[model samples]
Target: MKKIVSVAVSAALALSLAACSSKEKASSDKESSKDPVTISFASWTLGTEKEQNLERLMIKAFEEKNPDIKVKIDESISTSDWNGTLSAAASGGKMPDVFALPQIPLALSNNWLMDITKMTEKDKDFAKISKAVRDSATYNGKVYAVPYAQHFLGYFVNKDLFNDANLDYPEYGPSLQEFTDAVKKVTNINKGIAGLNNPFSISDWYPAAANKDMGWYTYKDGQYSLDSKEFIKGVNLAKEFATNGYTYETLTDEQKANFKGENPEEVWLQGGVAVKWDGTWAAPQDASFDWDFIGIPGGRTVVTNDFVGISKSSKHPEEAYKFAKWMSFGKEGFMKRMKIADEKGKMMNTLPVSTDKDVLDEFFSIQDVPGIRTAYDNLDNAIVEPVKIIPGYVDARFEGQTGVKAGDNENATVGQLMDSFVKGDLKVEDYAKQLDQMADQKTKEAMDSLNK
Candidate 1:
């Protein structure tokens, strides 16, 4: 009878311990549920005071809406060393939850990005983003990043210089010939005023301007036509501009000696250059004279975009996605950003990727630069700068993937071939075919590597 009593007491003790353990787990889970998740965000743009403040304001607004999530700004990453910094972070398993993408191909190759296709598909606002912008972040039919901001590649005209020359300001979309003629008319070698700056980017702009369907370097159908007639024409035009007095690069030694300013290189800012090939973000904030922006010769232009992505190593992906959307294409976030800019009486340097009417309306109201609206309107026809998307583009263009040397210089790369042509050391017709072949082969190799 005593033995039976002992067994009953032991069973009772086991039951009590099990119940206590279950209750403890339930209490711990409740506490964990209430704990806010914090995600880290890093951006090179945060190096600037104005941009940092703007981002902080946006973050504050985001936090107000998302009380369960917190964003911590990671300032250790910087513009000059962003790539190296990110590489180190990725290797150490300490990659920020969200960060700006300095190179999309690098990010994709390293598997740094998370597959956010599902999140984007479920997001109604994402559909409102421009197709080209969306396509820029997509690789192999998968979305890995989002275009956070963009700047249009075009001409920034000095109105004062145009009026002084008695020449009408070039309209928004001038033909190549019209643009060339205007450049000639505006140039006054005797006065040290150049019609255009050294148009090094003629090769980039000419083909696109000449052919509406072609992108930079005549990229189409996943191949480059660097040796095409259109490309040769662009190269010849660049050579012609340099040979003539229209561009600063071809100016005579005498002309340089007789330049009108203490710093002849400062001609653009001194209002001595009629039109400068540059990006919209380079627009002068407080100029001594009036200025306006216009698209490059053709109706089509190039756009440089900065992208953002959620890190694959992020522990809180859902929260990270919410923050990334708010800072990128989300309409509500854009509205709040515009509100902040308006209140501060400052203009945003980056253009919105969203096509939402309300977002655009707010953005345009705050960005009242001359001809800016028309420039924005032309985005429908613009091509994104290729190096950001095309695999091995940087290698083919800059890193000597072609193994072709310039002239007899065994160490020279395919990129230097253009400079040689412009300088009259190499003939465009002599090497166009070779360059086309090299570009195609290198690009194919890159694509194949990616597939593998």
Candidate 2:
């Protein structure tokens, strides 16, 4: 009887052990079958409700396609907070899997982003990207990110105002005189309208021509060129807008009161102003009003592409990279994004920077808005804004430095501001010397980082 009981207990123990092993195998297989993990994305912002919803939808679509991965996007950051946010994340080793990267050589050289040059070369679609956009992202010999869309610097004209003033719609590239004359024809203050206007205000002029505000960044040689002849002319034109009463200026208390509605796109839409120089992003947002646009005169029409980059600290680098490529390179993915913008009927001012000839031609062919056609027509002369081309160039030299208000007198001379900055009169260098120094600093900073 004792032998029988012992044998029975041993048999039961063996059965239990076998069951446990089978269950463990099943669990391991399930774990292996599951997709890897999540990634984080950060960008400058998504200001409007429509934009926020569009972003969420796009993210959802991406996740749906990439079921194995999840993306957590943080869009609640102001421009002031962006640098600190990225820096803190980097220091903590908890940076987003992908983030909006700085577009210039200096910020990129800091080594916070994954090198995307190889990816661009390896991917066939890389050939389809805009050269200017790619060049802006390239540091040394490598490209670090893919730019998504083109944001052009152009003038939005109220067609009705132009007609009322017996003026033609602005040409692709008008002369400076032509621009001024056109503005004068359209000015009608009693009707609460101006000839032309932007929020550039007194101190806002210098940066408008050279800073991130205008997208005119570039570097060459060892110095920067914010005070270049071309740049100076640009600022001079801005000042002209003030001096000629084409822009908002406060000569007296009453004038200051009139300058209150500087950004009233509605006013511009309703023909309150003859023109407003804004990004392509403005067109879609002003659907209720009919409008047209022309490229700024004499200067190369500039555009800034929104750059998409991967974070070096991401846990799921491969997936993050794949997602960036999908968003930036895949036809289906990008088209879906464009479709979303089209659906909202907001500013479809963004154009594709893809190397695809079909995409480019189609982009031009689809004239959903008058501004779209005008921009497309002006493409041959298009150049990315100087600020977009050169990173950090805007902040270092142009920010609040040398516009109409730089001299502090409302009636201060534009030439004095230019001479002061270009000549380094405030103690930087002679005007010619200042330009050379800026170009050199920018070039060295960009190339050195890339080589590293």
Candidate 3:
């Protein structure tokens, strides 16, 4: 659930990919032929105390397991600053041996990644992963990424808040109308608790609504159906929540800042928001006021998680490959990392990506039991966020979404558009029209580029 947009693009929401410059190729020389091979890794998580600690433990286990490779860590202090750091690293010939992906196509095109198809074939852990997930990260028959974690947005209920309001518990996959009805029951913004926040990010309700109305993005003849009745219906429902002050759209800037932190789980500690619309990462437990998460009522699951790729500039490709395999799918290393997560009660932040029944069974056993059960139920019919969505047309109407392209500005971004629509500055019908026009043009452009 991280923003994947280009850093050059405004820091909107996630959707971008890029690669290292030629400078990367010049640094293939080894430190010394006699010295133990060293592989450097980079992580956005290197900034957080909890994540950095977890990473150190994982690396420690990996080192102990191999006993031959020494790891160097280059961390980005903030995910917001990650784009600049990554671009600078590639341009400066300092790309790490293993790093998580912010963008996909650019990395694959510029040879920023190593093809790990052979490794996946031989690794039993990969065999446990889903084909859809593996294929989503593939380009030209090569496996460039190993998706390590994935998640979707859902309704996290503060049971006490709901019970106090006399609202019934949400069904696992409630329909848009059903969730809306539930929100109405609990939302009393005058009292200081929002009925809900954005489903995943600011204005993410559009996609969540689309997911609820249709099991996938509305595409007709290869064009996104932004103006479709279902889309309009979804947007209207979100607007209804805003109008009644049942949603985070009603929150003040300071309130928003508190909930938008790196560790937003702290919001639960206060215990006033009855129904918080957030992703899997934010709802990993029930300790804060007897809470639990459920999939978007009647919505198709959308997974956008972290991925690891090996840098082409690596002098030790095999060692880098070994590290990538160990982190993502190697049974011993992966489980050790999972055990650390369990010990520290950080399963939500460090969920496993493997689809292997045995590994997952073991993973579920150690992590949040109730949360994992809900997750398993939700992922049964999940779909990864398609590249053709936000990533496909950052230059067109989605500009503010991926950040400002040369001709784009904030007023026209997906986030801004939704904000206006929700605030009544723009009409839902008009917003739908704007989206439809962009969808048609971008869809054609995407097709043309693909054919080329």
- Which structure among the candidates has the greatest TM-score? 1
Model 1 residue 410 CA deviation (Å) reads 4.0
For residues 1-452, could you state the per-residue lDDT of candidate 1 as single tens digits? Answer: 99999999999999999999999999988977886899999997664555557777788889999988998988767667998889888888889999998778778878899989999998999998777778888888889998888778888777787788788878777888888888888888788788887867888778888987788888876888888889999988888877777887567778866465555347677777788888888887677888877778876756788889899989999899899889878988888888887787656757887878788777777667756677667767778888777887876666764444667776667678787776667788988887788788878887877676
Best of the two (2, 3) by lDDT = 3
Q: Is candidate 1 or candidate 3 better by lDDT?
A: 1
Each prediction's total of clashing residue pairs, residues at least 3 apart in sequence or on different chains, is 0, 30, 13
All candidates' TM-scores? Answer: 0.87, 0.72, 0.76
Give the range of the ten consecutive residues with the poorest summed lDDT in model 1.
256-265
Where is model 2 more than 4 Å wrong at Cα?
1-32, 46-52, 74-80, 102-106, 190-192, 198-234, 249-266, 284-289, 340-349, 355-367, 374-381, 388-392, 399-452
Q: Write the per-residue lDDT of candidate 2 for residues 1-452, one digit (tens) a residue.
A: 99999999999999999999899999999988987588887765444545565556667778888788898766543468776777777787777787765554534655677776666787777766655566667766777776755677667776776776677856655666676678767776655667766524212233232333233332332344555554555545555565555553312345534533544555565556777877777663444545666666553556667776777666777788777766665566667767766776544435666647666555555555555555554554455655544643554444422324344555334345443443223322234354445445645665565567
CA lDDT of 362 in candidate 3?
82
* Top candidate, metric lDDT: 1
Residue pairs of candidate 1 with colliding backbone atoms: none
Model 1 lDDT vs. the true structure? 0.80
- Please give the range of 10 consecutive residues that has the lowest summed lDDT in model 3: 12-21
Misplaced by over 4 Å in model 1 are: 1-33, 48-52, 76-78, 249-253, 260-265, 345-347, 401-409
